[model samples]
Target: MVEFERLANEKASEYAYRYLKKNIVGLGFAPNSKICESDIAKKLGLSRTPVREALLELVKNKLVVVYPQRGSFVSKIDYDLVEESRFVRLVLEKAIIDIVCDKPDNRFLEKLEINIRNQKYYLDKENKMNLMQLDNEFHKILFEMANKLQTHELVESISGHFDRLRNLSINTIKDIKTVSDHEKIFEAIKSCDSVKAKELMEIHLSRHKFEEKILREKYSDYFD
Candidate 1:
């Protein structure tokens, strides 16, 4: 009975952490908004202890910041952190693309094409969230093909920040151009033009940096 209780608490903690992280990434929760442990516990129908434990996990991930006397709040977006993450992702992705170039597989290419088709379909429907998810899936498929599991996990763990930024970018940027850029990437990959594919991917990733600048100029209030 005690073991079962412990397992249940552990699962609850995981659930709470996932909920908080998703809400934060999806921008469903405002940055620096006060997050009450008791409120979360009540919402999840769990005890405060498990929710507290989950919050600590979020803090460790830099998704949430806890104040001693005050309550916990979502972490503010840091441009420097986003820039650093972009650099790291670029380096790792370039290496993975190089490997794929050396030994390209049809199966991997097929999967990528399928993801691209799904992305196009979502874009046509203007399903931004699904499009965003499929975009990530396309990159994840590339990394998985390269067998960079650890690097993929690290990128994915911090990808929430990037995801949120992309959400804002999609809202502000020209939709057609963004969709066309993805199409270019898919075409390059299909032709086995690794160099072009890599270049296109770099452009796609850097698009958000441009959006960040525009947001800073036009909507500074939205940022931290």
Candidate 2:
């Protein structure tokens, strides 16, 4: 599969885990918000035991902080974690862009074209969440075209903290700019301009650098 799909058959615990993870990473839970297992169990129509297991997994991901008696809370965004993952992602993505630039594939270009189209459509409607998903697919598809999908998965897996930072930073970034940057990278790849593509990809990944301050100031409680 090109993307991570929900399993038609997931155990109760796995279902609870995925459901909570998406909301946490997507900013629905909010930074440092209370994570009430009983409340979540009712909402998900599952028992508290499954929700408890799900929260444990989230804790390992650093998305949830558990304190006995006090209860669990959504963790704050860690800037250092964001930079570390961004470094790994940029190094690998730049390599993939270099490879694709050298051997421009029509199939890959078409896929990106479709992604950019959807990005624009969502941006126009102010559907930021969908736009964010397209943003992820845009880069994941890059690695897929080069058969470096594992690299993308690795970057994504280690990027949970970075993803939260990005979720917060996106509020400060204009959606049109994100779409515009993707367009430039797409054009660079279409023309087989490896240098330009690499350069554009670097800028795309470093957005957190400037937006970090803006996010912290806007949502003071969300930052670590």
Off by over 4 Å in 2: 1-6
| lDDT (Cα, 0-100) at 88 in candidate 2 | 94
Decoy 1 TM-score against native: 0.86
lDDT, each prediction: 0.75, 0.84
lDDT of 2 by residue, 5-86 (tens): 4477888789888888888888888889998889888877788999999899888888899988899999988888888898
Which candidate number has the best TM-score? 2
RMSD of each: 4.8, 3.2
Candidate 1 lDDT over residue span 1-224, tens digit each: 00112334458888777777777877777677888889878877788987899889878877788888988998877776677778778888877877777777789888877887787787766547777777778888888888888789998787666776776776566653566776787677667778987898788778876576776776564466
Q: Count the backbone clashes (under 3 Å) in each candidate.
A: 0, 0
Best by lDDT: 2
